[model samples]
Target: MEFKYSDNDQLSVSSTREKIQEEVFNAKCRVLTEIRECGQLCDVQIRVGEESFPTHRVILSASSPYFRAMFTNSQFVDPNQQVIQLEQVSADTIRSIIRYAYTQQCDISTENVESLLVAADYFNIVGLLSECCQFLASQLSAENCIGIEKFASWYACSELEQIAHNFFMENFVEIYRTSEEFLHLEPENLCRVIASDDLNVKSEEIAFDAIIHWVDFDPIGRTCYMAKLLGCLRLGLFSTYFFVEKVKEHRYVKDNTACRPLIIETLKFLCDLDRYADARSLGNFDISSCMLTPRMPHGILFVFGGWNVNSPTNIIETYDIRSDSWMSCQTAESDYRAYHGTCVLDGLIYIIGGFDGMEYFNSVICFDPVKQIWLEVAPMYSKRCYVSAVILGGHIYAMGGSDGHTRQSTAERYDKNRNQWSFIQPMHQQRSDASATILDGNIYICGGFDGVTILNSAEFYTPEIDQWTLITPMLTPRSGIRVLTYKNTIYAIGGFNGVIRLNTIERYNEKSKAWEPGPEMSTARSNFAIEILDDTIYAMGGFNGHSTISSVEYFDIDNEQWYGAADLNVRRSALSACVLKGLPNAKSYVPSRSRVPIMDASDTVHLKDT
Candidate 1:
């Protein structure tokens, strides 16, 4: 295929090559000029197949976007120094990024990530940098994150650093923990990383020490100690020793480590559960010291579980609206348990399964306030503790519960007439200490423990198919959280965050199928009780991080917020409550602990209805 070269052909080929080289040279000059003259730091260059952006341009522009943007118009350039390789990003992607840079509202497709990131970092566009950081965090991977690591470090992107910390924390054991590459990271950053499996505590300690020393050199104190602490707690590496060491030296924490009177007041308030008779001011209604209960009974308000002292009682008390007092109606027909579930149907108070210190009970028992007797019904197939139960469509649905050792996904239904237990489809996730409530023909379950971890995911039960369908997860992962339905929406309130109790509240929108952030409780807690009266959702006693609270408060669901309410008389959890369907008597309706049956004395006492 050899042919003699003609002078005209030779000149034409030479001219084409020179023209290509000239275009490359011009792109390089544009990037350098933007950086040196315009103060735009970007490494923009054209990338052609198998070609390298000139070495001079690579060195001069380095990681800046100015040099990278030159390739926006040229289809042919060097590949190695393109900033984003020609093979990876399409021409349209580059165009979109260029558009986004000039106009704030332009849509930048995901394919333009590299160019946008380079531009964001190089130009010092803080807003764009944060947005890119968030976007990158969402699509993070070991491969992609590795490439972006150097850029993140060069630009001092604290947000990206946190994002990396979270990603590593969740996937450390699976992807990065054993890798030599990640193992070489600074001790502090290493500590910030998370692993779902087991934490490398010793490695974390080493990193934490290094960070403390390095942070000492930081005068402005930009380092995030709280974020690091949360990371440690999430990874299950936090302990009394870690807390002592960190709290003693960290600058972020408040000086007062000792408990105050307010703390005690908070504990009292949470322990009150839903008995708000004694509440005078917001101060007494301490909002902090309790966890949210998965089981919250309507109308009953506070149903006192047996005391927590050495002599725990099997007594289950109910707060009656007509009486306005707390009284132990009768010992639970089943076992003496804390964290048991109680729900009221018709005139009977149903105390479902819970733990009795040694064992979890699936036994279902009902008590009649009028008959003054407890009757045992069919027991659930699986024994559960820290469980939640809800009545939907005239049937009782029992969700997740622990077997005193492991969480159970299995659920069951109780037929009122037949007095028997039947199995229902299990939930997607096994969770104990979760909350369930009826809303719009669906039972919404939120926040619970699955033996090893707290869950943020939620699901709904459709009575039509008798199946559980997954829904959007809550914003926070929690266990021992309580949920209530008011105004057709479900409110999730107060729960343990493993490290401490929380006061954060959120709700589920049936129409949207999403959880929206809601008002935070005055006191952080778990194992608390929430009830709705009129327009207000009352949050009663439960345990906070350090202790229990007698605090009570209410939230205006319609307003999407909360405010303090009257405190309860006693600090109690694991109580039962029911809306007082007041008898048609002439008078004498006061809130009390004992529930009076809606029937008259002449009504027959059927064992099934007890």
Candidate 2:
């Protein structure tokens, strides 16, 4: 391609390409496989477990460094010798390995992957080894991750080992309860796992329970390790009642005199917290002790890029539920997006259509929480601000929003695999500043401003039918309302009602098909970021009629009332938020051990001298 300028200058603008398609590569591979099958120019016989596999020495030597050294170096092999015997691997595994060497394809399954990986490692076949490890890594579950991690590490498959280790720690509770291999873990590896800062447990009780179970599995050999494992827990985080009643009186602690000092330290820590409960303010207390350092959170709520005082903000913050604190994440300088739509899919956060204060955007940016990077993806077909988005059936639906000039009834569906967005059925009404959520295999979008008036109308879209149907209207007119589905029920919270901001809450009664009253927030807000974590709906920064505010609060099902939580670091409105679960590098998003502070003025609790 050539670019012509008005000044009579021209330049070539093109990308050079040199590549072969998969089918083309496979065609060449098929020739190698066919010749090997025909025994054409065969040079070697690999014998394993009562079976002999004929092969070409050149193919084998090219595919594996082990074979290369054996065939090339006189010190390793004799030129006259044609047969090599392998007793470590079965004939089936050897056959698969030979096939892969010829065709770059291997048949791997759960039953054979482990043994196949051993054969690949022994033979130094990097490609086959990688495929085997990848197969095992994909099959990692709580029940088998510990064994897989150990297996990968023993073979020096560093990438697979790291992934397995991350999964093992992130799902520690599940593995602890379900994995037989965890109970049989060696003391050193067990200590390493439990002591990692990456350990993910909502509470320290799970870690303590794991210790008891692992010790109980082998008391004779593990009794001495009781203190070592016990020391790894954040004992200070345990409730006073639970600590004194359960931990203090447990046989593991009572029977071992070596555990006496740890118990005393925890008691002192609890006593100090109780003593300072009333006297010390949140930030004044020293909370840098190892016993108080929080583990990696099971989930992290991200609040990023919002409309601030006079313009869009470039700020991004993470709320760590376990630590009950917010830490500002250091992100690359990016376009500040406001009124954006956010959806997390397959551990990646997608920031959809938004406004950058100057223009509405159809562009999309994907955030990799694991690698802490940003990338541009395919954009939407229509420019949108105040967009409402939801991920359903693995497809992201960007619903009605303003295109800067007017309210839009247009919608589109994004295919992550194709990096493309195609048209979807528009809503019944043009809506802006609406909220959308997934409930019962359908996408429900609630109240929003339709340019002329704030709307109380609500509707749902069924992907199977590709149509929208009107539902019951809200009890009050609302714009910028936050609607979410929790435990099969839909709750619509704070928003503006044209004349003023509203603090009221109403829930949709599905059977009755009407909006019922729920608890109201303390302060009225609109255009806020809301998400559910630990069974609580947390609402973050939003507009409070006159100005943007940093206040945050929550409403829990068990209490049936609203309660305040820690506020955000920035005051902003029109923000987008989502929670990412089971992130491998969650520790990077959260504050380190030294930076974690136990209390803040926004959220303080009293310890009743227990």
Predictions: Cα RMSD each: 25.4, 5.3
Find the 10 residues in a row with the least total lDDT in model 1: 601-610
**lDDT for position 220 in model 1:** 49
Candidate 2 global lDDT: 0.84
Count of backbone clashes for each model? Answer: 86, 0
Kindly list the per-residue Cα lDDT of model 1 for residues 28-74, writing each as its tens digit.
Answer: 65665455345354445434455433233433333335544543335
Local accuracy of candidate 2 as per-residue lDDT tens digits, 144-193: 89888888889999999999998898778778888898988999998988
Q: What lDDT does candidate 2 reach at residue 504?
A: 95
Q: Which residues of candidate 1, in runs, are more than 4 Å off?
A: 1-302, 306-335, 558-566, 583-610
lDDT by candidate, in order shown: 0.57, 0.84
